[model samples]
Target: MAIKVLVVDDEAAAIDVLKYYIDMTPTLSLLATFTDSRQAIQYCMLHDVDLLLCDIEMPLMNGLEVAEKQLGKTAVIFTTAHTNYAVKAFELNIVDYLVKPISYERFLQAISKYKEQFPTSVDDHFFVKTGTKGHLERINIADIIHVEGARNYVTIYHGTTQTITLLNLKDLEQRLPARDFLRIQKSSIVAIKHISGTKGGSVLLTNGNLVVIGPTYKEQVAKVINSKLIN
Candidate 1:
């Protein structure tokens, strides 16, 4: 599935360059471009946008305003000439924030986050081999409940079923990518898509699986929740 992207920047040159990089990536497709940040927010409300590339300072509205309005449907990556917005951008938990004048290399790095967020599933079901007869697994990315570490082994929980793989939790974490999967504890990483909400000591996944939150990972989890990725 091609990623539908919206570009919002006040500068014509910056928009052109950013669009160029987006076009270069075969997985991404440009949905629209807006010089006015206010119009960008309207576009977001009307359209199904997968990713957003927006500038911080604009005429009618700022990038953060645009991001706050659009964050529910689209993953944002801020493009700005100023360095001051970086901390705020991180606080927003944007996929990737780039300082202008942006290079194609840097642009590519940022867009890679989009790919990670919306990976193309091979089939409705796939296989993860662990050298013992190589079992066929019928897995959909959206159906994933929760993942937990049992010592050196990682357990994949989906629906009412569970599968244990020889891979460690960290190794599984690397494979899943941080853009969609967030580490809630050293032993657990919950899929952002699967998260319903957080309450008390529990992280509630959409599939109704409740995972415990670790004290060490509370700050990072707070950042994720406060950023409004999940309700």
Candidate 2:
């Protein structure tokens, strides 16, 4: 089934641009487009939607407010010109934040990341501790790598640099968003983001790290790879 999507923005031009991209993607279908924030909320409350693309500067209620109200029902992707809202948007657990004049490439990249992290239709986030120095790394649902288990702690590897932290894998797992991270084995949990290629009983990550896919995790690995859904 095509993903049910809603585009909300007071600007008619912005809505048209988003609609163009939505029409290009075969896996996605537009259910409704709203110029008013209140109307969008009403429709969302009444119906079920897979994804929501909303503008932050609406008159009645802002995108952040709408996202808080939606909770976990739909994947929220914010579109706006302001960069200051990046941090705040992260707090809302949004799927992706696109700046104004959003290009087709960037939009597609965001959706690609979204599908990779949310293969089973579950939307969520994850957290990792870098060290005991009162510092914690909170990652978006898509930006995680395999958690390597050490003797007394687990090291979280993400971004360009491999970050190792002083926290046990078990404790970290409990703190992380359950739906987004899946334990492939006792010692390792690979992020849906870093995964690049998969075959047999192993998976290749974007960082060039190859990890073994345990028997129990085979289904999850396959699902993650297939969810990319790109031709």
Worst 10 residues of 1 by lDDT: 122-131
TM-score result, candidate 2? 0.52
Residue-level lDDT tens digits of model 2 in 69-132: 8878889999898888999898989989999899866887778777876775333455556656
Q: Per-residue alpha-carbon lDDT of model 1 for 1-231, expressed as tens digits?
A: 456789999889999997877644445678899998888888878888888999999877899888877666679999999999888877877898888888765886887776777666533334555446856555565566688898888788877777877776654554453456667776887878788888898899876888888996687678678888544
Could you tell me which 10 consecutive residues in candidate 2 have the lowest summed lDDT?
A: 120-129
- Candidate 2: global Cα-lDDT? 0.77
TM-score, predicted candidate 1 vs. hidden true structure: 0.52
The deviation in Å at residue 6 for candidate 2 is 0.2
Which pairs clash (backbone N, Cα, C closer than 3 Å) in model 1? none
Give TM-scores for every candidate, taking all chains together and pairing residue i with residue i. Answer: 0.52, 0.52
